[model samples]
Target: MEDKKRVGIWIRVSTDMQVKDDSPEHHERRARYYVESRDWQVEEVYRLEAVSGKTVMNHPEAQRMLQDLRSGRITGLVFSKLARLARSTKELLEFAEIFRREGADLVSLAEQIDTSTPAGRLFFTIVAAMAEWEREEISSRVAASVPIRAKMGKPLGGQASFGYKWHDKNIVIDEKEAPVRKLMYEIFLDCQRKKTTAERLNDLGHRTRNGSRFSDTTVDRLLRDTTAKGQRLANHTKSVGEGKQWITKPQQEWVIVPCAAIISVELWEKCNAILEEQLSKRARKGRISEYLLAGYVKCTCGTSMYVFSTAKKFTCKNCKNNVKVADMDEIYQQVLKGYLNDIEPKMYVEELEKAIAEKEYLLTTSTKKRAQLRKKMDDLVPLRVSGDLDKEHFAAIYQPIVAQVHQLDKSIPELQAQIDFERIQLNSTDHVLKEAKGLYESWTKMLFPEKRAIIETITEYITVGQDTIDVGILHLSPSSKLTSQHQFMGSWKLPT
Candidate 1:
């Protein structure tokens, strides 16, 4: 046994995977059978039951396999299918690189990929295309079904949120969550008058599930939530161009069972009217003057400079440089055009595509890492419970790990939110590229600011220097201003 070569078997089944009697155990036995038949040591069976093998990001066994490979512990990975290994083609390629670097081979029984054979490599190529196509197909089907589901007032799937409870496969009247729901409606209604309802709620001792005090935006989001009124499930949908929608799909959808309604549809509509009325009032507050080099440009004075929207003019209060509110849009148009003119648009798009891939990777990996850490912490709890250490000693050691876990847990949701937002922005990347091929399209064709708003939201100002320009972004401090993503490139120069 000591002289025998080591092998690891990985299995992943999605939550939706049908089970017959002891299917997982059966898979385990089959994996064992395969490993035992080989002249290899069955070192470990990393079983990821009820997990999605499609994504390495959230898959535990996949992460463990990669770790082992990096450590040069294992030389083999066997899975039932290629899809049981990874979902994204990019991820599959990434796995291939990892395997190739570590002198490991991927063995997919169903796909008959041995990684050592030419035929196996060819199988991999076919699998990659199939995996990509399957992913896109699933996404498109979900997207198309959303509008129909929203129209049907079905419960889109989600956990029983703070104020809801599971009743007969559907979330029903949770009295504890009911008051918060009512408060949300009232807050939405009162926000029109700047009523500070969230502050009031906090004073009244209403906390979120995480025991956090509420802000106005949180209150507003809750008020607009269709789930509170039993009009829709707790799932998300694309709300673009015109109307908002929710989606539901049989068992996949959030159970949209009747719960005691916190507010009526009529009342919800009234709340929306209040939001609209307040929005109009805010609109009357005056134009939002955006700057061209807002995020990536910095000031010479070494202060955090930004385009301050005043009634009279858009001014850099720190540097005291005045940019007329009317001229700001034209300047941004110039800046974007200048970027395209200076750099190749095709090249820039390619760079952006790479960036999107990297960002998505980072996001997914973070989620996976957080889950792994939390799993560790959950496992450790039993040791602590068994009087492994005194309370003080336990606190001294475990507190930081627990805190870090909490931070990661919080981060996952925020990262998911950002991903959701960016997905919306990048949905029309090809269209945006097409638009760029033509002359700079007019801004303000839509009420919402698009590219300029995004740039300004991220940047502070571009700093002019003899050699390079510094792009500053959302800088609150002097040091932060210098270090922002404001790139100083060889081809680019800042405005004097």
Candidate 2:
């Protein structure tokens, strides 16, 4: 009997909700039936769960299936539909080329495409061309519709921005977030600095629509975006290469539709002017202020913390976890003390061991060279004793070697000193306690960069809650006693 065709099945569902639906199961059963009816052997099943078909490269299982086909593990590929395999025309063509090169057939059961015959090849070619054309047409329609939507003064359709939310497909003021928006504008106009404005907003527990912490870049963008000012600007660009490249049009081509403004035009202009001035200054100086706990701190709401300077505190962008610098200092000191005073002092010992290992690694090359030089000097002595060399000649070779050995002798002691210093500290809780206390006392005097580095080195994250502060330690995993993400630091009513 002729060998049965070997084929692999491919399937994808865009979201978890689809998994609960019987549609994916139905498609799989249909695909399996189609393969079995053709008397083909099922080689493997490639399933991409909860992944969108919009991007071809995002599916790992699909890529693996292609590899298997190329390696001759499977002679044919089958799927319920073409869209299940790929959505983009580029991806479709690429898949076609792969199957053609590998002498494999593709069967998309729903599309009735069986690329093993000449008639099937013609049908698929026509269908693929229509699919590519439809994609382009849809994109063009959407681009053409933007102006009409903008002219009607409605959102072109996406998640609502800060200070506003979607209501019946129209942008409406979000009463709760509006005040925060006003606060951001008022603070920015007052400070005339985007970083200061960002800090102030964070201090007040305001965040962007995405719940991420504010930065100067985000602050500047928010200040300059006309959407917040209740103006709809659309048709910013048109498709240039099907849907690949987008070239922004000139300012005169922009569509401006009026809507409910979050802030007055006068206030917007004032803030923007100051922002422009700041940008020009930064351009000249080429620098911006750095936040200490920028990425290390996470809000209880699962967003990063943004450092604000209004009340001298680092605050969560997504929650009301605002904490004063002095209070942070106190909490941080307590956490350090807890680590240093542990019964085994295991954390300190780990740090000491790391330091010892690092020094030992650095000393290896130098130590080897020193030993080699010493051996050479000893060989010279034997050469001199055998009368193979004159006294002056032996001295010539011996002096530089001795000097080199002297240099190694100096370096070897320094390496030993480092090793011993770390070793001694492992046994001394007093040393750890004294060091922590010194850092605490001198905390106020350290440079901003220095203090930030030290805090980041010891801490994984510092999460603030309503009644407590939690600090995550670096060396120990999150489970360590001193490294709890929710340890209570005595409650204090934070300043509003």
Model 2, position 261: C-alpha lDDT score: 87
Q: Where does candidate 2 stray beyond 4 Å?
A: 1-136, 237-247, 280-496
Instruction: Write down the RMSD of candidate 2 (Cα, Å).
Output: 28.8
Off by over 4 Å in 1: 1-135, 143-154, 160-162, 186-195, 209-212, 227-230, 233-236, 239-260, 264-270, 283-496
lDDT of each: 0.58, 0.70
Residue 64 lDDT in model 2?
A: 91
- Each model's TM-score, in the order given? 0.32, 0.34
Which candidate comes out best when scored by TM-score? Answer: 2
Model 2 per-residue lDDT tens digits across residues 1-496: 9988889887777654353222465556656666665567989988888777777654678789888987989988877677888888677776776676577888776565666543356545665566567667887777777777777766775566677777887778899888887788898888778888888888878787779878988877678877678885676655553234667788876887667888888898888888777667768554554655556666567776666667677787666577766667666766665564553445656776787788888778887898899889989999999999999999999999999987876666456444533443343333434455456557678898987777766677777776667788764321243565435445557545
